[model samples]
Target: MITQEKYRTTVKELLANGTIKMAIGYRPGSTPDRRRPLFIRTSEEADQLVLDSTCITNLSGYLVTEGLLSDEKQVGIFLRPEGIRSINILAAEYQLNVDQIVIFGFDSTGREVRPLQGRNAGDFSALLTEIKENPPLTSKEPLLERVEKMNAKERFDFWQEEFSRCIKCYACRQACPMCYCRRCIVDSNQPQWINTSSHTLGNFEWNVVRAFHLSGRCVQCGNCDRACPVNIPLRLINQRMAKEVVDGFDHFAGLSPTQEPVLASFKKDDTETFIL
Candidate 1:
């Protein structure tokens, strides 16, 4: 297990050496067991860094925040396995430059905090490959299994019921690293692609559109899931879409920076069973 002191010492060295202009990691939250994102510019602030299972918030979303990375200086970020995948997705989609960010990778599984070796996102290719080849059993959530058992109508009804509680808060959109759009479809009032109201039809449209937008690009970080105030199973929708992309296009999202997004790429021999 990587101790807090070791993590702090490493971050301090990186800061002192001018390897990064800023470091983004976790600090203690309001509650005892909670952790929140912390941005540190000085080596002395390194002591505030902490890593644990509660450090689950994917800080990759902050990487593409407005003017956050505009200074042309290298920025360091503490990343989990999923967060690294988000970085790859961001690079592939041209949202950010992969070379400008330095990764301090760590995996906090169960109660242990393990350090990962990688200066850049591509450095952990082997580890990512291993994870893709052999996913951990714990990766499958029980809620997803239950949802799979429902019939088509039942599933639709389930989603309808869940979406009814939506208040169009847009928290899910804000929390997602892949949803870096300046103007979402629902926000477009010129043509009114989707209704912005929180009524049943509008809510359904918002949720479905959000899911489809993230269909092939989602990194399964569960940030959107946690950000929803209504406790909707947003991650399940993303996981199901990811599974379909894999089975249909043989494409996995964010595996490599060079890989094309599943939805964006088209092939001559692609399957079209759904087409009449």
Candidate 2:
């Protein structure tokens, strides 16, 4: 609650001084445990801001809305550490300019929400490095362990059963910050890449293609997992892919705005274990 009040005051000050044209934060939702995005452009709107442990949705995606930053005015946004990494990825891809953003970073443990001491993405370099060295325990949970221990055929069956439930709603893609493609291949008819219907085979192809696209770029924010209406374990697939890149290339996604994408760039000594 103290942190919440501090940010409200900060937003009000920034707006009063014309430091930012808008601020994106959270507000109470329909339920006690839910939160919705609040766009603050005035002092009265700043009063509606809510910052707490439940404010976990990555609000960075809203930064890419068309024409929002065309005027080049700064926009302040509430972000978690993962959200900061996302902006780095977006900047690296030329999706948005980091200079136009002012970060209000925060993270939480249990019910305690604490402010992170940084206003720009570059200011959090050391902290991001620390996170890359020691990732969160959620990445190594028992479910991922069980999937990793499965034989090839067992693993195929496992994911097949999960993919069978997909309804092709694309909620996972919509929720992901990394899926910024203006015209996704699934929607393309030029060459007709994958089956567009919601059959199990189509579902498998869609999910696989999306996972492959995010191989080395996912921040594991769990937005896709939470947004899946059918409750597919989308995080497991992305986490497995992220681990593969780190082990094979020593690459951690979103370390900086200029970091080369792991799969996009090639090196002479790149691992070729699967070449057989």
Candidate 3:
């Protein structure tokens, strides 16, 4: 409660002094455990802000909404560490200017909310590095382990069963911060790269392409996984791809705004063992 009030006061001060043009935070939803995005343009709106464990959505995606940052003025936002990572990736991809964002960062342990010590993405380098070094236990979760133990044919059967449930809704793409492409590959009809229907083959192709695109770029925020109405294990696929990059290229996504994308860069000594 004290932490929430402190941020509310800070947000009001920022708005009052014109330090920021707007703040993106959270507010009560239809239920107590739910939180909806709140955009604060004035001091009164700051009073409605709520910050806690339920504030898990990556609000960074809203920063990319058309014209929100076109005026080139500063905008404040509440961010967890992963949200900070999302913003860093956005800045790296030339989607937004990090300088124009004022981060109101926080994290939670169970239900206790705590403030992070940075107001800028660069300020949290050490924290992000620590996360890279010691990822969460969920990285080696039981479901992922079960999938990993399966033989190639069994693995194919498992995913075939899961992908069979897909309806081509594209909610996973919509929820992902990295999937900011204006016209997704699935939407292209020029050459028809992927089938538009929700058949099993089309579902497999779509999910595989998305995972490959996120190989060295996913922050593993679980947004796509949660957004899947059919409960596809999108996180597991993304995590496996992330591990491939870490193992093959020593790359960690969103480490810094200026870091080169791993798959896009090349070196003479790059491994070719998988070529065969």
Better of 1 and 3 by lDDT: 3
| TM-score per candidate, chains pooled | 0.95, 0.98, 0.97
The lDDT of each candidate is 0.86, 0.93, 0.91
Worst ten in a row by lDDT for model 1: 132-141
Cα lDDT tens digits for candidate 1, 175-238:
9999899988888899997888899889999889999999988878889888999988888889
- Candidate 2: worst-modelled 10 consecutive residues by lDDT: 136-145
Report the number of backbone clashes for model 2.
0
Task: Report lDDT (Cα) of residue 229, candidate 2.
Answer: 95
Instruction: Supply the TM-score for candidate 3.
Output: 0.97
For candidate 2, list the clashing residue pairs, or say none.
none
The TM-score that candidate 1 achieves is: 0.95
Off by over 4 Å in 1: 137-141
Q: Tell me model 2's lDDT, rounded to 2 decimals.
A: 0.93
lDDT of 2 by residue, 130-244 (tens): 9999998885489999998999999999999999999999999899989888899999998999999988889999999999999999999999998999999999989999999
